[model samples]
Target: MKRLVRLATLAACLFATGTVALAQPAAAAPKTLRYSFPIAETGFDPVPISDLYSLTVVAGIFEAPLEFAFLARPVRMRPNTAAAMPEVSADFRTFTFRIKPGIYFAADPAFKGKRRELVAADYVYSVKRHYDPRGKAGRLYRLESAKILGLSELRARALKERKPFDYDAPVEGLRTLDRYTFQVKLAEPSPRFLYVFADGSLTGAVAREVVEFYGDRIGEHPVGTGPFKLGAWKRSSSIVLERNPGYREVLYDEEAPAGDERLQAVVREFKGRRLPLVDRVQISIIEEPQPRWLSFLNEEQDVAENVPAEFANVAFPNNELAPNLAKRGILMLRYPRSDVAYSYFAMENPVVGGYEPHKVALRRAIALAVDVEREIRLVRGGQAVPAQSIVGPESWGFDAAYKSEMGDYDPARAKALLDMHGYVDRDGDGWREQPDGSPLLLEYSTQPDQQSRKLTELWKKNMDAIGIRIVFKAAKWPEQLKASRAGKLMMWGVGWSAEQPDGDTFLAVGYGPNKGQSNHARFDMQAFNALYEKQAALPDGPERQAAMDAAKKLMIAYMPYKVHVHRIWTDLAQPWVSGYSRNIFVREFWKYVDIDREALARRGS
Candidate 1:
């Protein structure tokens, strides 16, 4: 009786103190979405990185000042961390934005448990980081053209002194009007200046405390105000991201263009729903296509971004989901990506690069000899369209009616042009030599992979037909990128996806200042550079379109790049994945994705 009274007294005391509550069953398990990438992400730091794969991961962990609407057709920009769109003045040379109040950064050791509210000064600091000499931002030239007031002067001063960049230094171009408001002043009218903010790298906010705290390790420690936070990362193997517990309540919303039934249905299904429905996202890096495809077939991954060409027929025959996969409730999403794949000729190389008629003719002949149609059909499984120019579909200044000799597939014309340029099979060895009887050998840089091997075989066959001697230099993607940027590669195969809907993004790659950066070809032409500058200053209209076309024509005339095809990517998602769609401009789609846990359990997935 005494023991029972003691227990009763303990329970009574616990209840009186409000420590005891009714027993309840455990909550359901958190939902998770699994995906894969063909290549390992380089790092999370946005400033020094240019690869899309790394930026895709960064886009989720970081929030840009402006973002593309999740489902908006004709892609429109929307304010993200910013309270609203910036106010433009001074003939489009000045832009002012206000940071939203009460926005908090993800918890980090740098904050020391105190809330780190985002401010306008953070953005100013972030933009200045791009200009730092040590950063080596691949897209810094995009801002260089804008001539941001006093920013170049600061960069020059830092370079001259060979000192660490002064992050606290103020510039007239990037000024904090108040704690919440910031203004940008450009030397000239920049119609596309907003795109600089819309870009994932340029507009991502990096807190000063976080950067200073992490120092050289900033890439591994990314703290932002996005919906997801970096959880675990094993280099070249796997990465995991968990939901941000302190994320602000935001809903899925978009303004869809009329006459798009598919987008309309998607908007209806997910409109007004709270975002970041998935609890965690796990991404596995599977470089080889075969293993990546096998993982998808085994149901280990929820989504397969790029289906291997070998399994194209097995997964989607006649452009429809295979019967077995359809019965299993697997769906395929197909669309023309806003991108272009091409081979660039380094203008500094001795053999392939020059302004002389012979060198230009050699590039033009090779361009004409390439059978992009066959590449699309055999290599890509008819999942691409032959590109007419550098600018792909969905970008302003991409003219479907535009015609150029560089994109044509005419082996007869190729041989004739080669012969006219004095390139002939000297000594009857079946390989063309330089006009001066010098050994003419072209080196092509390619990744050592199944797809690249097949593409190289095609290239060899085409060159053989035109009597040109070609050799393949195989390197990994990252190595090839480094070599190309250093002007070491003679020719290389690469592609570019639009960072924005503007054609200026593509044109900037050929600009003189972007050499050793995006202009891997090192293509510096006065006429093209003049036209590019004119187009950057104009709005989207006939004048800008004309300049864009003229620039494309000049590139074709010089043949710095042999444009190939615009890929039509087909993405597959398991039934358990919900609210998933490919956004043309946005890479961070995890926040909008949800997992059907009950459905996954029922299917044993």
Candidate 2:
């Protein structure tokens, strides 16, 4: 697909004169923050595709089943969004939740723009959509809905046979007590039910009116009760959003006892606070990093993300960005990336036969040979920090102590492991060979971007010294992703943004169900799967923690992939935007923000 670079260029021109201003006092005009990124959002549908660009636009206006405030913020799992939380019945098979009243979807002209209250039927409708055979909502199926009473039977008949599901049927165990109340009779208790609600894709409650209104066009015109409303979406160029007045935050008083940190954070951000501050937010698609930085530097854009490495040394130039901006010390919010950028060695269809092996020695040899920290410092220009695990330290269940056993530089140990496994270069050809004499010359695929290429080249230099020949293969983003999923890759560079704050999102891809869908390396671990199942059945806290730790440790032990680096995203905001906070993923940028009136005045000045 051709990127709409001109749309961003035109939008850049649109705000060039800076004529558009938020309605505010002449003394200090509120700032309109213009954020730009290289990737273009494909659509507003939250069903899961790599591009998170459009999700940001949609999330701004729509509330899902769960909410997150990036890193360090507690995750909120709504009762309306979840079937139950905290407690599981003694029978360990049923969970129930009572919904709160007064919550409503965004007002659209179709609904007369008046807030429409949400109901239990809405959630039932949303969950059923995922079970639809025709619905390509892969992320939704990641949750083991079969554990929910009637869901198991429906899943057994409709899903097992791969047939279309009739969502309107009367399921045996699913029932609604009232308009705002619902209960699910689980086949067994799932302590991690709260995690499912917060999975965004799993828990996002959609209005029945929305499903019926657009029918199939709901992806284009989604309606949710989020802080913002979709305004104008000029495909490939820019997507705009306006504040939703119907939205209210759950406020917290100092008197409130210790509860869910995720719940508390949401209440703190929105409760009693008038959001948006700015009338509209414009997201520009600027694929080339150089041009994005140029626009921000020229004051053509209010905020810029993923600032190119070239500008790292110069982002703060003696207050040159906006003059008085230096006096404010440039508010920089740093948080660990929910997504870890890593390199994977695909064993090819031949190495692992028809399936990839979950071997410790083989993966350890690969991990030991690679020097991750050095690669990050040199190739990434010190923009990234080493990542030992796929899940960052900030993620709810991630274990810092589980950083892969393949510690700092050790070429001798790497070679020793291979030699012990009978992988040796007997011919002195500078490449290791199997017992059959086939050379271990693997092709490494990566995006054509400069940084990725450099990282790949670094891998080549390090691995080649250990008698492993790695040839670099370059492909565009879409091509690379397609090939990776198809298992047509021998090795590749890949990254993931946490769909929520847990290991469940990362673990879902590699299991049998997701196989080719997301598990690019095509590795299947039985121990990991068992742990995931156990974690799901147990309630949140220590029991679930122990199970998750086992799974995480197993993942690291196998070394299915090498963690190159975790990152702290940087967004350059033109001194005007006030409540702008960094999100764990770039797509969450819309959630918490308030344009600065003073910044707008300075732009005018």
Candidate 3:
């Protein structure tokens, strides 16, 4: 009887333990969002010199002076802190912005515990910073300040007189008429001027004190009038953004067309019910593609911006989520690409004098003989789309019909073309030569990555069947960029991506004056330049569209670069996230997003 009593006591203890375990509430999941990128940022500050990598990462933590949003089915432009949108003159040369009455920055130790309100003078100061010849602000060079009144002259004078690039000159271009109102004058009427202001480039406002304090290293320790402040930046690790308490919730004009109905509905559903959705956004640097994919699958990462081409198909379902993710995948989204690639004959330049005329002919014949479709399918593995026009599909004027007839894969025709060009083995040596008896050998430059290695091997096989002997030289990204920029490539590969939605970004790179900046092909033409210049001059509507189309047609005729693939970026993230879109490349989720943990649970339910 005593043993039975002990056994009962043991059973009672086990029941009590199980009840406690079941009764205890589940631990609340920490309110954290984790994101990943393929590359590491050089710094937390985004300056043009640091390249686009750091700039994109930094742009998130720092806020620009103006912001863009969709209203009534079109993109609407608004100032970050203002009662209403700015008023612009009919010609779009002069813009007047009125600062709101009570908005101010949150108290930071750096600001000496004072909440500094933004003013019109701050805008003037920021624009002038770009004009500074110190080359401190890279985006300023992109602004084409020449379009702005006297601002261009100041930049030119700074260059010629050996004075620092100064926007302090009393010019017609920019002025603070009063504390609230500021005016910007332009050289010519630009219909897209408002859009430019809306863009992050001109909109980011900074305090003059902060600007003077940091001076050269401002890109590293940026101070801006945005909703979030840069908390910490540890290189090759992560960047953090802390929400500013002084941040005013943004509201748009109900009557505005850019106020999207669908987005409004979503916002209304979450209003007041689940406020301040996301507490923090932690963007982690994950360089390896496989690790990033694994992190996304494991739910450790809230968003994987760039899904590897190989894993995208396996991980994403063929549903709205996948399609939405695909649309959002375009990171650092730019519309005009600055780089292009093409096969060049070294014989054209005497520096590569070793390549005989017959060998050159054989190479050119091989260009027409190779099958681009097979190359795209077998090598690219359906991740990229074939290219016919020098312009990528993301560009404004790319037409698909231009690729109809570039000649198919026919080894017989390749040999015949070579034979017709007088390339033959006259001495019974295995290698063919020109009529003048030079060896028909070619050298191709490429990188040492998996895709490149496979593509190069396939190209060699194709060339071999047509009696052409090719050599492959593997170089790093830097070496490849330099060689291509110098026009030293015989036949090589490169990729082009854009940042803004304009044709000029693609065509302007190859233009005569700016050739060094982007035109890797070294291709030049007066007529093409004229068309492109005219297109850039037009406003961003149908008229501009027509001009761009003509320019793209001419570009397609030249075939400066063969398009290998066009990718619609595919990204994956949890459903709790909101306010993220595919149209623009923005990393800060706190600025635009409001998450609902309960809603996410409901979604799963």
Candidate 4:
């Protein structure tokens, strides 16, 4: 009887333990968002890297003083780390900013167990890093005309001494009045300077300790105070970014203009919610279009940012979501890109790059021969529009009614111009020769890809029609870019996306000082340079517009760059992805994106 009583006691104890175990809560599963990049990101450092892919990744890991409103239609600037908008002087040369307190950088070894709170001095240091000649920042020319007081002298001194840049050196243009207040003084009136800051160029604050710790490997070691931190990177294959656990609590809020139904719905869904809804992000680099498209269709990726032109018909019929994809609850968002794709004639090259009348006529003839409409229809699957000028449609100085001869397609006019310039088939070879009887064969650099091949064939046909001989040189995109920068390639095709909504952003590429950097053409026109400077000093009004128009006309007349087409991109998102919107001016939309884990699991995505 005693043994039976003990057994009953043990059984009762087991039942109680079981009950307690069932009452406890379960741990939540992690939420992750998967995506892909058509090209591998170059690196994390923002100073030397100018590619859009790298900038997009950098945006997540860095916080700028100012940022674009997340959901604004017209796209307005707002304070991100700043307490308020900058205080600008009447002359628009001096601007002061106050940063918000309590913001801390992500914990790193460089911090050495000390809290790294962001202060005004951090911004000053970050800007100075770009001026370091050793860094060789790609976008340094953007600030060349700004002429920050004492900055040029500092750079000169550093070059003369051949020593490390003195970060502690005081520059009058960049001053920290206090712990939170920072002032920027420009030599000339620069109304668009704030826009440059609002973009990622000058906004990201780099702690001096972090830079010192990383040294030469700073590109690989990116440390910033943003929503996400770098998790893992496999050179050219994949990248992962995890949520910053120490990130400050910030809710999603924006003052969007009313009467937009789509934006209203987005606001209702995410207005008060905490940002960075997704816990993790996975990026796969799939260079080939077929594999990338297959991965997206197989539900491995949540978003496909750019639909390949070859699959445009299959993805979007009549520019709307295909019936099949729509049936699967997939969403398609279309936006006209604020970008331009063009070919640059290396003005430094002996054969093609010259300001002589015949050379100019030859370039004009080649530009007039190529039919942009046919190229768009056949090669791009109706995904682009003929670009009128260097400035795209969304920018301020883009004139819709402005017409030019450079963009026109006239084979007869092309042949006539070539013949008038003494270019003729002298050796009965059916190809034109220079007036001096030298073989006039143009070498064009292009990537070895299906799209590039198609474009090359079209170019060959156009050149043949005009009795001009051309040879195609295949090289990787980066290789081609390097060759163009070194002034080795005669001509090459490239594209530029606007970092800000200003015409100057596009015009700066042709500016003389930007040569060997942004200006691949190496075009140095005295008149165009003067107009560029004049426009930079004026505000976005009639005077500035006139100056910009004159510059555009000059660019077209010289034919240094044959501006081709502006793309219309169709972006796709899986059903499980929400709050996904396309912003041309901003690429860092991961924080605003959310993943429906339950729905993803239900669809087996």
Candidate 5:
């Protein structure tokens, strides 16, 4: 009877232990968002890096004072790290900003085990970095041209004195009003200056201590008070980011288009969750077209940001979601991309570059001969619209109905122009020679990608019909970009997207001062320069648009660059992805994205 009593006691203890174990909660599953970039990022450093892919990563890791609303259809601006929208003077020359208190940068070794707070001084230092002679800023011209009070003078003094920039000196135009407030005094009225504040890469605050500690390696160690922190980086191969534990709480703010059923559904799905629902993000650099698309098909990546044009037909046969993929619960979103793809002729190259009438005729003839429509239909898989203007359709001065010779493809006119300019077959070789009677072989720059190969094939056929022999120069994108900036490339095709919806951004490409920067073609015309400055100071209206129109006509007349087509892009998201609408002006959307933990967990199991 005593042994039975002991056995009963043991059983009671076991039962109590089992009950406690059952009451405990299970570990929460991690939410991860995986995606790919078609091009390799240079680095995260904002001032020198100009590539779109690098800036996209930088946007997520850095915080600007203002940001575009995630779901707003017209791309509305809202306060990000700032306490509120900046106050501007009636003339628009003076602007003041108030930073929010209590924001802290993500913990880093540079802080020496102490928390670093983001303050107005950090912004002051960040702006000074661009003016510093040592930084070699790629976008310095934009700020200098804005006529920021005393800022350009500071940069000029640094160059003249052959010394480092003086960051401590008080500049009349840019000064802090207090601990939390800063003011910018422009020399002239700059109505669109506020747009500069919205881009994180240009205006993102960086702590001086962090910059000093990392020095030249600051690009590798980006310290910011943003939603995500760089957890690991494999240079060009892969990049991974984890949610910032110290990130200030961002509540759900659904500002979608009214009565839009699709967006309303997404708003309801992410209605209650704190932003950055995804705990981690994994990014891979897959430059090839096929593998990038296939990874999405295999479900290895959660989103395909821009589906490859080569496989667009396969993904959406007849531009509709395929039946086989619909069963697996995939979503496809297609939109007209606000960008321009064009080919520029280096104005310094002896063969293709000259201001002479014949030189101009040769370029125009080539532009007219190349069939943009055929290229779009075949190479781009009918995913692009013929670009009528260098200024994108979304810009303030763009006119959709106003057509120009930029988009024309008349082979007969091209042949006639070539004949008038002394570009004719010599010695029955059936290939046109230069006006100087030298060989007229055009060295067109190209990449090794499948799409590039197809485009090159089309160009060969088009040029062959015009009696102009052409050869291709193949190089990696980075190398070609560096060469293009140095005026080493004869001709190269590239795309430029607007950071802000302004016509000036595209018009600035022809401005003489921007040569080797935005103006890769080096087309320096005094008349265009005068118009560019005149329009920049004018308000967005008929007067400013008229100036822009005159500028675009000059660009087309010279034919330094041939604007090809504005692209239409298709992006795919898996069933588990949520809140995936794209804002044209907003590049940072990772924080708004929510990964379904349960669905992702199911797939893993």
Candidate 6:
């Protein structure tokens, strides 16, 4: 009777206090998107880094002043960290931007217990870092060419005087007007300079204290006011990023481009919701193709960003998804990328480089000898179109109807040109000799990958047909990039992607001033350079088109580079994943993607 009375009293007390327990559901699992990089990333620092893979990682960790709307098809630019678009002067030489208030960087030891709000001064400091003589890399060509008032002078003084960059010095071109406003002035007109602000990889904001704290290891420690923060990283191996707790409230709002059902569906589903649907983004460097493709098939990877060409028939046969993959609810998105793959001759090389007629004929003949169509069919798995010019598709001034001899593959013509230029098989060795009767040999820098081996085989066959000896030097990508930048390479094959809507980026490769930078070939032609500048200054019209057309002709006429083809990339995603569109210009893509955890569990993914 005492026990029953005590239990009844306890129950009554629990009921009175509303403390009775009920069954609760388990907490949902953290949403994560796992993907892979075809190549290894160099570092997270935006200034020195030039590779696309590293820039992709940088875009996720930094905030730009402006950004392109994710769903806007005509590719509309919108203010990101800025409260609104910049106020531009009529002459296009001056621009002003207003930084949004209350945006804070990810908490770091550098903060010293105080939240660091993003101010206009932060941007000024960030831009100055690109010109600082202490450790700045040479991405300052575009800005230098723009003649950003006193900026070039400041950099020049630092370099000439052998002193540290004057960060405290006031420069008229780049200055903060107030706490939230910043203005930029150019000595010359630049109507398209605003596009540079939208590229976070080039113009992202970086705090000074953070730079000071990390010192030489700044690339490893990225502190930004972006949506995601670096959680863990193993250089050239794997990288992990987690949701930023202190990121400002940024909703996913966009106007879907007309006639695109996929974008419209994504916007309809995620409109007005907070951005960055995933909790974590996990990436791995898978240099080879087989393991990466198998990882996606096994569900270890939620997204296969680039389907390997070797497995194209297995992944998508006859330009359609394989039945096995389709049954597993996988989706394939195929599109032509705004990029070009080409092989270039080192213009300063002793054997192949010169403006002389015989040397020019040697390069033009070699360009004609390469079977670009065969490379596309065999190595690229019929996933590309022959490049007719340096300009990529979808960029301004790219005319679809335009044609040039850049893509022609005529071995007969190549032999004729070579024979006409005194490249004869002398000394009975069955190999051509230089104009001076010296042995004519070519050294091509190559990677040790399977794709490179195949490409090398084709190169050997082509050169053998023309009775010219060729050799290859193998090295890792980073090592090759360093050597290439220093003009140590005799010849190399690589790809370049457009950074903006305009085609100016393609021309940078042949620009004389871009030598030791984008001009890996060290190609310097006054006629080509003049045409490039003229086109850049003119608006998109017949005048600009004519200038660009002349520029392409010069590129082909000189044969500094053998433009191969424009690639077509295909990305595969599981059904549980949503909003996996391949953006042409933007690098940070994980923000707009959502994973259906419930469906993931149900489907056993």
Which digits, one per residue and each the tens of the lDDT, describe model 5 over residues 464-559?
999999999988777787788778999999888888878887887788988877888998999999999899888888888899999999999998
Number of the candidate with higher lDDT, 5 or 6 = 6
C-alpha TM-score for every candidate: 0.94, 0.79, 0.72, 0.96, 0.96, 0.96
Instruction: Give model 2's clash tally.
Output: 14
Q: Clash totals for all models, in order?
A: 0, 14, 17, 0, 0, 0
Q: Could you tell which candidate, 2 or 4, scores higher by lDDT?
A: 4
In order, what lDDT does every prediction score? 0.87, 0.63, 0.58, 0.86, 0.86, 0.87
Of 1 and 6, the candidate ahead on lDDT is: 6
lDDT of 3 by residue, 429-466 (tens): 66667656777677878766656777788878877777
Residue 464 in candidate 6, Cα distance off native in Å: 1.3
**Rank by lDDT (best first):** 6, 1, 4, 5, 2, 3
Q: On a 0 to 100 scale, what is the lDDT of residue 328 in model 6? A: 88
- What C-alpha RMSD separates each model from the true structure? 3.1, 10.5, 8.5, 2.0, 2.1, 2.1
- lDDT digits (tens) for residues 1-605 of candidate 6: 99999999999998866643433456777799999997888788777788888888989889889998876777779999999999999888999999999999999999998999999999999888888866546466666656789998898899999998999899999999999999999987777888889988888899999999998899999889988999999988899999999998889887777898878888899988898899999999988888898899889999998698888888998889999899988989998788889999999998889899999999999999899989988888888899999888878877788888898999999989988999988788899997678899999998877788888999999999888899999987888888998999999998888878788878878889888778889999999989887887666789888998899889999988899999999899998898888678888989999998777887863
Q: What is the lDDT of candidate 2?
A: 0.63
Query: Which residue pairs in candidate 6 have backbone atoms (N, alpha carbon, C) closer than 3 angstroms, thus clashing?
Result: none
Which stretches of candidate 1 lie above 4 Å from their native place? Answer: 1-24, 255-269
Task: Give candidate 4's whole-model lDDT.
Answer: 0.86
Largest lDDT belongs to which candidate?
Answer: 6
Error of 1 at 26 (Å): 3.9
